[model samples]
Target: MIKYLLNQSLLSMKKRYDYDVTYMQDILRTDLGAFMKFMAFQTMSTHKGNLPVEALYAARIRAIIWDDCGPCTQLIVNMAVEANVDSVLVKAIVDRDLEKLPSAISLVVRFTELVLAHNPEADELRQQIIELWGEKGLITIAYGICSTRVYPALKYTLGHGKTCSRVVLNDEPVVPKKNPQLVGSHHD
Candidate 1:
């Protein structure tokens, strides 16, 4: 829905991030070609269904990096799997408000995000689902997250969408202090 990196910039900047990579910050102020590609690769994912999501994600992400794809399917992938919904039918899901459907279903959305955000997010999702859906639920969540993360990232990278995502830094500014010994100690 939020098309283009301009708007996305505002949203992303408003949030606090955990790390600070120079290129991550540099990409935002400059052209999106490299930045978009980075995110598409970073956030990129693959579902593979009945197939391991990790493998699928790796391949999907690789395609964008190597083959180059678009973002339309990526958008669909981003939203569907979490709803326990099928991304292939994302265009015709009837109502696309699964985020507000019900906590029971909404949990899928949040859990899916965690999986992508955290490589091992599946562990937590599994633990939570163990009480209810049990082992099957955990596997399903892992698959969904992996599946969902791929396309959107791929699409953005390949050009399906036009959102530019960037990372900011919060750590102490690293000052390249001059080494007293290397400065003028020997200068007479």
Candidate 2:
């Protein structure tokens, strides 16, 4: 009964986002307890405590792009748009046009990059985030970064991950730019 309801929820998500949820379905089939736990963990990705929409989604989109450039990345982009983040800003982030992003958002993107890469430099950016948005906001961005990576990682581990594909925003396809600094850091 629980699996039935969960599958229905997954189907709704798949339809709403045009996303693939086969990995989630596989998890459900493999172990109900594990599937329930995974679903609980997914709540972290949506926690935006005290963060502005731009900052939260920027961190999420950046981290997902670092870990995946295909479906998972596109899913984040879609969610960002649905959350009413400006389509133009979403495009700038997708295109890696730091010049086009607002200073605050650009900072969040850079912070996500450095954190994902395990660089000590993220410390400075972290302080800046706390100043701008406070500790709760910092935690929100951290959760955004960490939780956003899990879907793609799980997909790849389950052999369901795909290669880079064109991501669309507002009905137009956008080619994502790879962060040169993070190139070869992972996903090589």
Best lDDT among the predictions, by candidate number: 2
Instruction: Report residue 145 deviation for candidate 1 (angstroms).
Output: 1.4
The C-alpha lDDT values of all candidates are 0.38, 0.89
Candidate number with greatest TM-score: 2
Off by over 4 Å in 1: 1-100, 119-125, 163-188
lDDT of 2 by residue, 1-188 (tens): 88999999999999999998999999998999999899889788678898999989999988888878679888999899899999999999888899999999999999988888888899999999999999998999989999998989998899888666778888888887778987777542
Q: Give per-residue CA lDDT, model 1, range 1-188, as digits (tens).
A: 32355436545633422212233445545656766675665432322334333223322222222221223223333433443444323322212234433444434433443343343554665465556556655555555445444544544554443543221112212111122323332233
Candidate 2 positional error at 48, Å: 1.0
User: All candidates' TM-scores?
Assistant: 0.32, 0.95
User: What is every candidate's alpha-carbon RMSD to the true fold?
Assistant: 17.6, 1.7
Task: Tell me how candidate 2 scores on lDDT.
Answer: 0.89
- What's the C-alpha lDDT at position 115 in model 1? 45
